[model samples]
Target: MNSHTAFVAAMIAAGMFVLLLGTFYFGNFRRQKPALWRYVADIDRAGAMIRRKEYDEAEALLAPLASKSDAPLHIYQLRAAIAQHKGDWVVAARHWKAARRYFPDDALGFAGGARVLLRAGRRAEAVRMLEGARSRVHNPSQLTKVLAEAAQSAGDWAEGARLWEQVRNEAAGDIDSYVRGHDCLLAAGRPDEAAAVLADGAMRFPRDPQIVRAVAAAAPPGAPGPA
Candidate 1:
């Protein structure tokens, strides 16, 4: 080939390579830059503040970021956590609600809301929130126990008994269920049933003082205590 023709071909090849490289670089930059730069800066700053135990300032910074319509769910979650740490229950609830709006099926948001309600002494509301969280929670036993305790506080013995039974069943080998079940039975005025439950528990856990005492307490006036 002639030198001129070879040079022209080489220039064309270099130009195509440059164009391809520019296209890929700019495309990657355009796709990643705004998300990485815009989203991460505030998130990282907020995280740093949280790590430094400056929850209020972290939350203040996160709030505007989280308020954006397109803000990430995690951002809202962080804001909620910050609000909770700062004892701002109302704001925490609002942030959690916003997080839930973005991810309706999020277990953490529901659980967090329930915890806030419980802390705020809104037992009935907490129970309702936990009921909604039941399907979403991987392990609802803790929340169920809290709900049962709330019921007990409200003097709803029947609901408390049912919930305690559920917790006892979930706990399986744990003695807490037996204790709670015994107390619940006694509280519900079913002493005979309580005696039976305690007797059975004493047989299974012979060394448990609570079980022994429960059996004794539930027995009829002339009934013998556990041997």
Candidate 2:
């Protein structure tokens, strides 16, 4: 063929290829859209069932999703929640680990597993788990907060105070950290540090009744107080 004829033929072929690709892409997306909606609906239904304490029903609803090879993180989380509610610590831990494996960047599984282990009276295990996962977590603040809670539960007042202080410093808007940090420092017999923490919270949350009361009570003997 002539050079001009060859160029025209090549252009026509390219247009046909582009048209075919667009057709296939849209067709597949349309076909998958309903499945995606159904998946979301199922997740919502399972969540409601879990909230109602219907473990069996929630599990049943999630079974199909769980069987899929590409199951999302929430599926494992829901499974872990169900297991935890049923007092199946081993199964719950396994599901949490699976979630962590499936979604490596997320801290939810590590936090959830640690909380469950703590609730099961495995304080050391909970601490160890969080410490081990700390380096891999996308957000260490979440894990740090849970570690602070674990410290409080274990009566490690010094450690709890330090962890709470770290938590409050790393993230803002958590009034619990300030209150708990003060309480922990007091328990550890550091009244000055305790007072400092409470004073900081009072400054940040001037209108909060709890902080106001705490600050008033935390005032040193014979010291001037908030007006």
Candidate 3:
């Protein structure tokens, strides 16, 4: 063909070559989304194993995903649960901590760690772990009492009082809050506050034998009820 026709053909060929080269380079050089579907499915299988109480097998399945950058956060959680099942508190504690480390903003991680600490009898640490996590904790009403008890156990009576009051408000007529709050105040050498809690309990629950007994039991000789 003529010079112009030949030049046009060369240009078309060059364009096609460039297009194919980029496609091949990207296909090989650039990492594609790793196929995480199988990892997710395996994680689910591990969960089933945990439910069946086959901790060893569950752990084996979870080992691969535990440190995988793209793995779901539940992998470490399941690992922690398995460790807890096996009664390895140390391992469980670290795994729970790792879960939180991987997801700083995740409530599940903090809750998991706090739960493990509670089970390990590290009451003070558990309460401290829960301090920042209380708002994010699941089932706040139930957890409020747990954290309050932990605070009381740790002798942080002010924190204990606050947590118990939170539970009392959320639970709406749970006598345990008033009773336990009174006990915590006594532990902290605050008899006046203790009496006030008991008096409140008696006011709210006039017929509750437990509150009446507590207030009477706490009253000084001949001082009358909750004066």
Candidate 4:
């Protein structure tokens, strides 16, 4: 062939080689650079195992990943959840505590740890942890409810009543909180205070049978009618 044609052929081959190299480089960059995608994939896989009720396998898969990365909050959270489900309150508490360390701002992590601590009968510790968490939480009604229950279980009826009242105020129209608050107040031996709480609850939930019953129950047998 002519030298001109040979040169053109060589140029086309070189161009193809450069295109192939570029494609390979980009593929490697996507796979090796950043690395977050692979970590995310492992998290997803562990989540799927959790959904399938394969707690052991899920924990196995997540443990190493959690240890390997700083962003493994979800992994630690899932491990805590699994441990709680398995009735290993101590293990759950440890995992949740680890998760909180990695995500100190995570309300759920602190809440979970508090729950496990309460279940393990570490009421005072749970209260302290939850109280600290409460200040950090933007919306703490649910966590307050949990703390209330924990305090009640630990025979701190007064503290339970206080927590429930706080939860009731934060709920702002939640009938369940009103009902729980009334019950907690009565249990705390503040019957008169319970009566007042119930009266206010009746105003908010006028048609709720539970609220009406709670108010009636809070009153003494010969006490005056609703105030």
Total clashing residue pairs per candidate?
0, 0, 0, 0
Question: Over the stretch 104-218, how does candidate 2's per-residue lDDT look in tens digits?
Answer: 6678889988888888898889889888888897878788999998888789999999999998977766888998899999999998888888888988999888887788777
lDDT of 2: 0.84
lDDT of 3: 0.78
Ranking of all candidate structures by their TM-score, best first: 2, 4, 3, 1
With a 3 Å backbone cut-off (N, CA, C), the pairs that clash in candidate 1 are none
In terms of lDDT, which candidate is strongest? 2
The model with the greater TM-score, 2 or 3, is 2
Ranking by lDDT: 2, 3, 4, 1
If both were scored by lDDT, which would come out higher, candidate 1 or candidate 2? 2
User: Against the hidden true structure, what lDDT does model 4 obtain?
Assistant: 0.76
Candidate 3 wrong stretches, greater than 4 Å: 1-39, 133-227
TM-score of 1: 0.47
lDDT per residue (tens digit) for residues 1-227 in model 3? 99999999999999999999987775565423345675878878988998999999999988876655556667778899899889897898888787666555556677777777887788778767777666664545655677877777778888898888898888768888999888887887888888888888888998887887777787779877643
Q: After superposition, how far is residue 13 of candidate 2 from its true place, in Å?
A: 18
- TM-scores of the candidates in the order shown: 0.47, 0.68, 0.49, 0.56
Instruction: Look at candidate 3 and give me any clashing residue pairs.
Output: none
Cα-based lDDT at residue 185, candidate 3: 78
- What TM-score number comes out for model 3? 0.49
